[model samples]
Target: MVNDKLLQNLSRNLLKILDDDEYYDITIEVGNDPYVNIFRAHKVILYYRSPYLRRILSTNKKKDDKALIHHIKLPNILPEIFQIILSGTLL
Candidate 1:
């Protein structure tokens, strides 16, 4: 089960990223099923299961564009992921 503290942190980070212009249209999903949490942006679809054990997956995108695929295993790592995504390093 996911920790409550972790979930709070993740939600905070996601909100911060949502304020950015570049990611304004980006979609954020959190769930158990990998298929359900997957998000599609333009021609790319970013998917993952969780933070630590999760494997980031993407399709129909170039290597450079794949940087947007940001998959966090836990809510605690949301801050880091948020920074990366905002910097355009991870999606």
Candidate 2:
């Protein structure tokens, strides 16, 4: 149906934003030590998509004054697992 196609297109577009480096307002660092991976994302998208992240963001609402970018570090999750988690959140 038309609606399904529209949704598919929307999802594709949303995924494109994940790789956009110019406009992202937040940096998420996943994992610890030598295995860490950093990802950039929009705060508004993260705010609405996941309740767990919402709670985390709520506590860390203050962005760095110089760059205006918020930073979050997750030492628990592996980078590979976090990528999968983030993709699910965007969908």
Candidate 3:
């Protein structure tokens, strides 16, 4: 079960962090299941299942280098994760 208030707060904080950076373009949407929030920017996308869990996927291609997909575990750390991703420091 996802907490509505917690979702709202997470979204708000994420937006603030994104707004502070000019290099990041952010798009946030609620998934069809109503239990996930999808955040997309550039070649990166993060699916936030709840305050305690989140999945991050990113792609980066450089010439002959193959594109890569990265996954991170965010456990009860929404704010920190949001800030890190928004800051473009998560890889």
Candidate 4:
């Protein structure tokens, strides 16, 4: 019982980082056309959470001398659906 609360607190604190946009290394653009929603996240945290994200980011990785922003655009997901997806990924 105590362990569960501790884990929940830890999870909430980590998820708060996403909300605060603290030390985010990557940006995700969900949807296209008329409108799009952008979300900032930590690359390392995302890589460990989802294999699909890990694979995509790996393939998209660029080799360059200068600093470049890591931007991922997903045209498939709608704004509302992406919110749900993001919620699930947090936990």
Q: Looking at candidate 3, what is the lDDT of residue 54?
A: 31
Best by TM-score: 2
Please provide, for model 1 over 8-74, each residue's C-alpha lDDT reduced to its tens digit, 9 standing for 90 to 100.
9998876565454465324445334442333323212123222422244333324666465443333
Which residue pairs show backbone clashes in model 1? 50-73, 51-72, 51-73, 52-73, 68-91, 70-91
lDDT of 4 by residue, 3-56 (tens): 988999999997787666757778889888787888877777767767777898
Clashes of each: 6, 0, 1, 0
Provide TM-scores for the models. 0.26, 0.73, 0.27, 0.68
- Please give the range of 10 consecutive residues that has the lowest summed lDDT in model 4: 82-91
For model 1, the superposed segments whose C-alpha errors exceed 4 Å read 22-91
What residue pairs clash in candidate 3, if any at all? Answer: 52-76
lDDT of 1 at 9: 100
Q: Looking at candidate 1, what is the lDDT of residue 28?
A: 48
Candidate 4 off by > 4 Å: 1-8, 62-68, 89-91
- Local accuracy by lDDT, each model: 0.43, 0.82, 0.44, 0.74
Backbone collision tally, model 2: 0
Please rank every candidate by TM-score, starting with the best.
Answer: 2, 4, 3, 1
Give the Å shift of residue 72 in candidate 2. 1.1
